[model samples]
Target: MIDFNKEVDRLGTYCTQWDYVEDRFGKKNLLPFTISDMDLEYPDEVAQVLQQRLDHRVLGYSRWKHDDFRNSIKNWYSKRFNCNIDSEWIYYSPSVMYSISKLIEIFSKDGDGVLLNTPAYNAFYDVLRTNNRKVIKSPLKNENGHYSIDFEDFKEKCKESKLFILCNPHNPTGRVWTEEELIKMINICKEYDVKIISDDIHMDIVYGSRMTPILKVAEDYLDSIYICTSPSKSFNIPALTGSYVIIPEAKTRDRFENIVRYRDFVNSPAILSVLATMTCYNDCEYWIEELLNHLENNLKYTISYLEEYLPQLKLKMPQGCYFAWIDFSELNIPGEQFQKMLIDIGEVAIMNGHVYGEECEFYLRLNVACSRDKLIDGLDRLKKTIDYIKL
Candidate 1:
């Protein structure tokens, strides 16, 4: 079993989450919690496999044997979610969002309506806007601490848009949508003929069993919907190879592929990274399960600690992913102010919520996928800083 309590030093690992904090956050040494990457190393077994592949020393162009890649991907979804995925329906892309941009080109036209839930992964907004598509914002309603979809508003907005870019197990808020929720969401999009482009990057690492895929929840075979997924976030293999784009509809899939003809984005990583990602899916199953349990423990402990000692700062432990959407509105500070205060004063780095949407002015996202001791230390620093400033 993977050791959940183990800590790997990432301070100078040339990481966006760790190494980039100084230039990005304007602090010489910031206590960073802003980025989505985990501060832990990949499993030793996985590392060994990659190192073995690296021993060949010649890094050159790679090709997909097709079947080998398909089996690894199909097996992951079938084993994890019990959803049947046809390998024929899968396409290759370097990054999930890169494909999302390509889908915007395929499914949507300039001046066409594109809808997004507010408080998304910032990149979603950037991609849509870069393509000159009109972005429609449908903000989720905050219920207590966790946020839920406003179905009524979602339906109305979907009616007006031709495409919807959805974030499953949603970013910033961390809502692991249930099957019922996914269907209701899809049905509404279907009614308006909106193509559902779901970003299922965070499909794994869920803390609860209630969450399922948008396709499973979607009643009937809604060919218009697109499932863009990757194992990058799931296994911490973003620097590795590619992502999967599953489109059940032949016509739509053809259109997506046609969009790719004008550009050259089918860049697969080194054969080593590809093999490593596939290996993680086929063999690292046990490690993922153990990691989820440990992360859930961290989320629960952090929430309880905040409630008992730092009541002014509100945090809702999510049902999926390693993110915690924290509300600091009670502290009467702006999101950036709180983020800077956390770094400058509390010595803890965290995400500023404003970039997600205007509605996130008082929220910040924190990653709890660290060693238990690091998480505890970060929490204690946050508590003292927030409380000390409260007076």
Candidate 2:
């Protein structure tokens, strides 16, 4: 039984989620429900294997070219998602964002348009802007709190862009894209000749509908699509810094590999990172199941707490991911003002949704992957501040 209740002190480990929040907000001792990583401990099996590898002390250069690493990924996809991934299609990278920036460079040129849904993962915006690619937003429609892709808008935008980046089990909103949704989007992208770069990092953390990988549903479009995934989010090993891309088409795979080699970016997977990922895929299913149960309880508690203590903040319960997308529009406060009040008076730090995109103002994305004590403390602070400010 994995203990989700244990509080881990991550204040001084250079943890961006906990240790750097004060620096980011310029407020010391602020309760952070912001960043995406969990406050949970690594799975015991992963931790043990990683430590064992570290003790070996053969810290020479390594590559993930072995069958053990490849088979772990293949079996994981088959067992978890029921998707068949060929070993040859898999290639390692230092991180998903690094792979994505490279994909953007290879597939599209500067000033050329790349598409995304609004209220996206914020770093995606950074990638596009840094690469000098034009961002074409195809905003998702919010109907009675559930989010749906505006298909017509997406189709129109596909006509204007040659590349589309999809975040399945989307960030901030946490709606797992259905197979039908995936099919429709794939069809539109296919008709318009748009290459898709699907980010499926959050697939393992799903709650409601099972996540359908674009690769599984759009086999015919493999030549123009690829998936960027990592065990970092699933296994809580971001510091290990390993990610991979699945490109089934040889020509595209060769082109991407060439760019990586040319840039001398053939980053060998860390010894601990490789062992951790292998452990996650091969030995940590039970731990992940327990984690899902804890996350479900956290979501329920958060929704009930908000309804009882702060009904003005409407929360759309997430179908997947640990984030809660909350609507504070009824409070009659601008998002920037609301965020500032939360930080100053409440001493709570959460992602101000406006940074996600223009349409996300008045929404706050709260990360709930923490100990129950910490969660309750943050909620209490949030409620106290909102009440105090209303008076």
Against the true structure, whose lDDT is highest?
Answer: 2
Q: Rate the local accuracy (lDDT) of all candidates.
A: 0.80, 0.88
Clashing pairs in 2: none
Using Cα atoms with residue i matched to residue i, what is each candidate's TM-score against the true structure?
0.94, 0.98
Q: Looking at model 2, report the run of 10 residues with the lowest lDDT sum.
A: 261-270
Off by over 4 Å in 2: none
Candidate 1 error regions (>4 Å): 219-221, 259-262
Predicted candidate 2 versus true structure: per-residue lDDT over 1-391, tens digit per residue: 7889899999888888777888767788789988778999989888778778778988898878789888999999999889998999998887899889988988999899999998899999999999999999999999868999999999999998979999988997998998889999989999999999999898899885568888888868877889999988776789988888998999888888887766666756676777788889999988888998899899899999999999998887788899888888888988888888888999999888887998889888888998999999989988987998789
Best by TM-score: 2
